[model samples]
Target chain A: MEREIRIDPVTRVEGHGKITLHLDKKGDVRDARFHVTELRGFEEFCVGRTVWEMPALTARICGICPVSHILASARAGDAILAVRVPDAAHLLRRLMNLGQLVQSHALSFFYLSAPDLFLGWASDPAKRNVLGLAEARGDLTRKGIRLRAFGQETIERLGGKRIHPAWAVPGGVSRPLGRADRDWIASQVPEALDTIRTTLRLFKETFSTAEECTVLGDFPSLYVGLVTDDGAWEHYGGVLRVVDAKGKPLVDGLDPARYEDVIGEAAEPWSYLKFPFYRPLGYPKGMYRVGPLGRLNVCDRFGTPEADAELEEFRARGSGRSGRVFDYHYARLIEILASLEQMKTVLEDERLLTPRVRAEAGINAEVGVGVHEAPRGTLIHHYWVDPNGVVTAANLIVSTGHNNLAMNRSILEIARRTIKDGAFDEGILNRIEGGIRAFDPCLSCSVHALGRLPLEVEVVGPEGAVVQTLVRD
Target chain B: MDLVIGIGNLLRRDDGIGPRVAEALRVSPSVSACAVCELVPELVLRLRDARRVLFVDADARGTDVRLGRVRDEGSRWGHTLGPEGLLELAARAFGSAPDAWVLSVPGFDFGYGEGLSDRAEGFVPQAVERASRWLSEGQVSADGA
Candidate 1:
């Protein structure tokens, strides 16, 4: 007899997600669903506040990725004032952004997803977390902790605090980095560089499974990201560009204020998160991706030397005329390296430690847009302010919102492949969740729609005994 | 020396009301002089030195109290150890844990939405009042002579 199995309120990962799988009479394949459960009203809340308060208020949306919110908000704030921040300010902001990327990527690899990869996917559920990984590989775990700590320290030194620092303000940072902080950041660069090398080596040695390499590779997606005028991935400030599967630019030199004309969010009754797509393309066709995968596919070259080497290797493995989805997974490590290298470049700059960090901007209430590359993906913050500086309207499109379509497609692909396995097991369902986990969607930042997101699953059974009983949350 | 502990996931809507209130108390005109440590559950070890303790957290009682309204806890409270858990964990690590009472705010929603519900918003002042009273009473007599 076969049934369905369901787990709601999936723990460990931030926010909530539900996993459901249906089994046939012989307990074989049926169907599966990975539905995110949560609704965020950040956009609505942004309606009445002042633009000045947005950088700090919006940053509170997610504790794990506040830097993204901070930098993104600061960028949007800059647009409204029509003031170009100092060069030192731009460099310092980039350094902090890199710090965020390093820490967040390290967390995703070592803390959240590593347990499944390192301890065998089928291992006991109890011992399949960071703690379990530590018990098995204490030295590696220690190194991971130190690496994350160093990244966070870099952020704190530059931004002034670990979680939500008030450093990246509208004009620039609140205060310039003093010599002590700059020297402190400089001293840690060598160790930081070493950690990046060690992490890449660890990923290479411990991971690199044939299944990982082949599973979601070669799939096509419309990729969008920010790149500097010199063709390097830009985290601080750059013109937005969209590239199709063949690595051909579809749109370039996009201004943030005009995003409403390019991007539009659609609602699906089955999920809480909204799926954002290129408005001109319509629903399914409009589906696009943003994040590490999208960023890698969209960029012509990485800015840093070490990252450029990894990017070259990534291109070699892609058999497609353009980049493949396979490159997206590989690019994860390369981007982390890029982030680290970028961190070093910013820390080594002497102008970053100047005494005057904050700049004065005359009050000019107008519409503004801010976009920055978050660890998860590209984030945009758009606001409309009155002459008094009070926010009149706000709209935010987060990285997870951008990746919703791709995630759904990936989940179904994984489900169709494993749902019919003869032995009938939960491994297939877990793998589907694992596949989605690679994207690291931030549901807290995505879920904001009216109405329920419907989910359905069917299970067949010969005698209808207890095999699997699952329900979507 | 006893301890006062506040625990809540600040990101979860009204669940964070406790910490917000505690933060307000940390700077309140009444309790400004007292040194109180705020912590999450994982870092409860910092409370080991206190003899008497006060714990604040959000609670759901099915009905009655308004959202955000702070209650002194009923006689037949069925809730788990609020401050007691921290003390217990501390005792396990060291030797002894302190005694404490939990101040609970009736919660409406702990969803991912922003801003506390009106019910929860209304209880902020009441929570502050209870904390002031508890602080004025102190953990216990300071007499060691």
Candidate 2:
């Protein structure tokens, strides 16, 4: 009498995925699995390519977060060269990463997930989208669009193109900031700051009382992200930090090059994405969360004044324990504020206008590992190259991969609370999707094998027979 | 000024038509042309300053290459906004939306890889000719002829 429920092609997320819930004869949820169906084989194909081409080649992995890959790959190249990037180039890289954070987080909160937060979850599926949000709240929609544009414009100004710009090179960036570009970016900061502030106020007022905030992926889990030496929230360069669910620092200031010693990837048969876990604890038991929630939890404070104040208020929301996955939305908003503040500071720095942007060097090392915080979470790129600088082996631990284990657990937790006696209603189904969306997992970035699997849901009986099938094309 | 934007991934087989057409049309001095991999919301700001805008892309729904005016439509997701969505954003955010058109090239092969399919490549010249005609006609109309 046991039955299975599947939700295929989880909508409103970056890439394709599904959730399968196993039920007992009593119809209570027994287990849940989150499946990533497609694979790109980036790691395999990247081998034998010249290390110099990594920034540009890997940038093509995902159109959405190519900047993250470009920067991370370039950092790896810098490691291979064994040369420090100039100070101005470092600051410029930080600016570009902040722009990425702003655009990406805005896209997640406003475009992808806002409909469920603003419009009722059970509302018409047709009306539950960015267009619907625009129809109902035009002002908010406009602000979201403009905020995203501000981020994209910043990238375009610095990197030369909106999507894949090969500005970040091995030793440093390709060019320094021009006066016009710096002034234009400086001019846009005030409005960008205003938009984020307004968004934060509105989001807090609306969702603070919602029941979804408490039950949707609210369980405690370990948190991981990068932080500056003084423990400031950092996106570009920092030492890796891991904190337990209780806000205690389990490990801090670990060298990113030594990431293999601290973390390991575990593969599951049903999923192409690898489940990355803390090395000592082993497998599922070492499960930790990343992205906005992890970054905020792992960092001690935001260095800027306004962001630090916002961070204090954000922390007080959970009474100092802000591990709830639902809080990721708020964490994204706070990070946006911090990014804007950091951008303002960086743009005003005169050193960025210096002509010296890159450091020339030949490959000095055979192995290199680069780590940085992508919009999703901590991303590490490891490469082994020959003396000729051709890649021998490549491994990428994308942010979504690190959150794979936690994403599965979250889906199960939400399903247990929402589904009733094997009922697969639309509302319950959406709640399950909402849980996954809360993490904003990018399957395209995580899975690097080979498959073009369609999104499907199969209802299986206790005897392992397919009772029903649902396909989303 | 008038703008022509060709949008699609150059890495995807037939999807590179948009950029291909844009590249071919770059010789025309009457309008500005560029190729982008995707149509993002940030395009609205760039469109706001233009007198007219044309977006070119490969479409599986089309049987033949066609050109038509852009219309405002509801969007289901955030990232997949098309020409119409960008126009709508322009109108909503800037209070003025430019005249916009979408030049859709019918494409059969959209699989992973570079270069256009033979069928899609056959239509490239015609697509370029049609886009050029539109630009020339627009120039004549704008000149008060």
Candidate 3:
């Protein structure tokens, strides 16, 4: 009898998504899919708006990572203006991006995925959540909250709002960093550093050898990220870098603005998210993973003392590329450490206090493209402006879109490995959801609607009759 | 700390009511008001010490201002959260949560662009007045009378 098992609206991730396993006559799993069911036309709405309003307008794309859009859009605006942004504005922008990484990565690691990693994958669904993690690990949970707050507070200090700050503008920032706010951020750094280092230790000591490391989307695929000219780990601005499973650099220092030269976006009917691949390699064969795992793989060094040592230890365990999606959690912790270390350097720069920030200019170019590494992965924003500086068209390749192909392949691999021959349990289903959690895909980043999180799995018999249903509410 | 938290997006027409009410309430120095796009678990820290917290949000299901006790119903939390969920987290993390209520201000349009629908705008002062009274005097009974 042919059967189909469906997991609708996988929980604990950003926004709505689903997973389906197609079974054959023998009930063996034949195929699988990860579908992103939501879409918002941001590109369409921004068509006739003046280019000057884009940074503030596009920042509304996602509340969690609005700084990513703001920076990318502002850079595109900068290109349109054909003006060089002041040094202080760039420094302040880097600080905000780093802060976002810490907060966002902490949200992924501690709140979302930790419940599965720490409380046992098969634990009671009702108790296996952020609330449960708080009960079981109160001290750790509090630290995670504060650590995230440190990042949010840092952002609030700079831009005056934690969520969607209208700070980063086209030529530069709206205002320079005030001394009082700067001092407050500097004071919070020590505790933030202490919390992240302790988190790394806790993660390594507890779950380094867990079974999740093997089955949770552990596969060899190409890695992609932004890297400095010196091949250091970068977040704000840098050239494109790609490394293969063997840890060899496949592409080095390509202009990220000309991403169309090396990347192709493919669409599958099953999902709204586009599958981005290396144009040179073609289609599915060019599947490359991005985000923390990709960042860790593509960078030669973290350019920080502590994260460098941690990276060395991280590399010694597997292929230097760290292809295992399970390692994203570990990589995020390392990046948080790197971000804090880098923040310290930025805070000490004497030029950081300078008041000269924005570079006033008008539309000097028709087409402009901006690229930056968001917390998720490389984010690109391109804009075409008229002579009067009104936007004619825009294209946004968000960080989450870059990982769509990898996510589909991941869920497919997980379904086959766990759900077999038409026999599956809730724990097995949770394992599949846990696999999706590994990448920490943000559906909200791609499309802005967020539905309720109720994972409903249904099993249909050969005649399309419903045989069974399991729900984790 | 007494908190008046406005949870919604300003870009969505009537959804801006929460922040508008919060913005209106800011004139009173007695309460600390903030507008957040969403309710995250990190907000638990702020809720930890909040003696009274009023969560003002746009209610899509109804057409009038309704003030009610926040039922402990946001149990299955994932990416999205609510006042009930944040309170649940506050209890779990800090052993206590603020005495809280939901001020559901009904709205007509939730589409893109700023400003409230005319009808929703009319309800703003009424919602603000009620929320301020509740936060300051604890006027609502335990049963939300």
What's the number of clashes in each of the models?
Answer: 27, 0, 0
Q: Rate the local accuracy (lDDT) of all candidates.
A: 0.68, 0.86, 0.85
The candidates' DockQ values read 0.06, 0.39, 0.62
Ranked by DockQ, top first: 3, 2, 1
Better of 1 and 3 by lDDT: 3
What interface-residue Cα RMSD does candidate 1 give after superposition? 8.7
Best candidate, lDDT: 2
**Tens-place lDDT digits, model 1, residues A29-56:** 4655567777777877777887778889
Model 2 lDDT at residue A4: 76
For residue A114, give model 3's deviation from the true position in Å. 1.3
Ranking by TM-score: 3, 2, 1
Q: Which ten residues in a row have the lowest lDDT in candidate 3 chain A?
A: A447-456
Better of 1 and 3 by TM-score: 3
Off by over 4 Å in 2: A210-212, A449-473, B23-32, B46-52, B59-65, B70-79, B84-99, B106-125, B138-145
lDDT minimum window of 10 residues, candidate 2 chain A: A449-458
Interface RMSD of 2: 2.9
Global CA lDDT computed for model 3: 0.85
- Determine which window of 10 residues in candidate 1 chain A has minimal summed lDDT: A320-329
Error of 3 at A206 (Å): 1.5
Candidate 1: C-alpha RMSD to true structure equals 8.1
